[model samples]
Target: MKKILVPFCLFLVTLAYSQDDLLKSLDSTQTEESYSTATFKALQLVTLQTTKMPAKKEFYFVVSHRFGTVKDGFDSFFGLDNATTKLGGIYGVTDWLAVSLSRHTLNKMYETGLKYRVARQNDNFPLDIVGYSVADINTFLEKDQYPGLEFKHRMTYVQQVLLSRKISEKFSLELVPSFIHKNLYNPDIERDNQFSFGGGGRYKITKRLSVNLEYMHNFDKPDFYKNPLSVGLDVETGGHVFQLIFTNSQSMSESGYLTNASGDWGKGDFFFGFNLYRVF
Candidate 1:
């Protein structure tokens, strides 16, 4: 499934960029100045560049699809039940601030969260950092229960300091220091809390194409949860960007990172994932 999704995501991303190129050529009235700022901001979000970066003034929508290996309930179907889906959006609140929200579909359970940028940025400093946080809720249910069990919801909070540093015109890197807390999600799992450090790098393959990779490490006892490390690549041709990735962790959001990760960092239980983004 991961192999199939990766190519499909890239195909769609390329298609969107192609459309953007056509619009740029046909609309002679549109000024490059008007679009330059927003385009750069959108690219930053997709690329996850580390450096003081400029923000956009326009509203943008992003829809991402992620699929991984089958982890549970094989009789029902091998791994078909393990697929995850996310739909989200980010808006430029100002030239330096942006906010975002997203919802994830996890089989029968649903997760939702939001993030906001608290810091402003510029180009000379090359360290575009944002203060961001997220809160997600997951409800538990049992198949053997009476017709339908009352939802016992669990909440998780995550706070992070996001920093991006541009090493050069073609190279950039980012570091994320994050804290996560989970509750009512797992009673036996006494240590459902964690602090994590993450880093990502981007290399431009061309003006419109780039490669990116990211990894996260948890600073806690390994017995409680398995630390997750992920790597991915990004391709931006025009208006659309394509991301192809692989990781041992399956948790999709901050809350999942704290409590739901089940993959061992040393073992080989990883799967591939992809993100396809298009702007209108």
Candidate 2:
């Protein structure tokens, strides 16, 4: 009886020790880091910038269109008869960086740009920050059309710092501080350098639908140009996003739309537009 009791006691002790060791091992396992994601689905929220980039090795083909002003009241098919279009492609060099090239029909302009994610929003960070820069060349102007126009006169440059935060699963907000430089300008009426600030937001309505709004205030706008304001809806499918927009801006490039928009919303001068993005 003593021999059997001694062996049973040893077995119970060993079993209890093994169970303790197993619990400690489980407790020591690492937990995943929590982070905020999808602050903005697409790169641009209407005319304002968003801190979004494609995944590494991915490519995005985008087509954008802005019809004539709605003030035409069916004379121009309520801004459908006349249109300005842009076609662009964005390629992701890495998870945090992307490059894009686009052409606009309004001024026969070509633009190239780079977007870099400076920082990401996470449990420890409050904002997602991005840097953007672009160069545009206007090719529509003829020597005869604008006398004394040199190659340098056709160049425009834009720099922007975009900051955004996802306050909730359904709401996000962004602010953009931008500077635009035109190599040539009307000395008497226009300044060579322009500054603008933009604000935009997104509110998700359904699983795959959202409302977006954007507005920019230019500090050095000409008398004829009104500040650009746009509102749009975004619909997401599996691999494509379609945006339906109403905007007072005609130009698609940052410099073109920010500093050169000529429509007035109060006068019913806004136009209908759409942007389509397909990813590959």
- Give the winner by lDDT: 2
Taken over the whole model, the C-alpha lDDT of each candidate is 0.54, 0.86
TM-score each candidate: 0.67, 0.87
Off by over 4 Å in 1: 1-57, 70-82, 107-126, 140-153, 190-192, 221-224, 264-267
Worst 10 residues of 2 by lDDT: 25-34
RMSD to the hidden true structure, all candidates: 12.8, 17.0
Candidate 2 runs further than 4 Å off: 1-33
Tens digits of lDDT, candidate 2, 1-280: 3454476458545744554344454345333345578888877798776998899999999999999998988699998899999999999999889999999999899999999998666654466789999999999889997889899999999999898889999999998878899997888877898988778999999989999999888888888888889999999989998999998887888998899888889988888999999999
lDDT of 1 at 82: 56
Residue 10 error, candidate 1, Å: 42
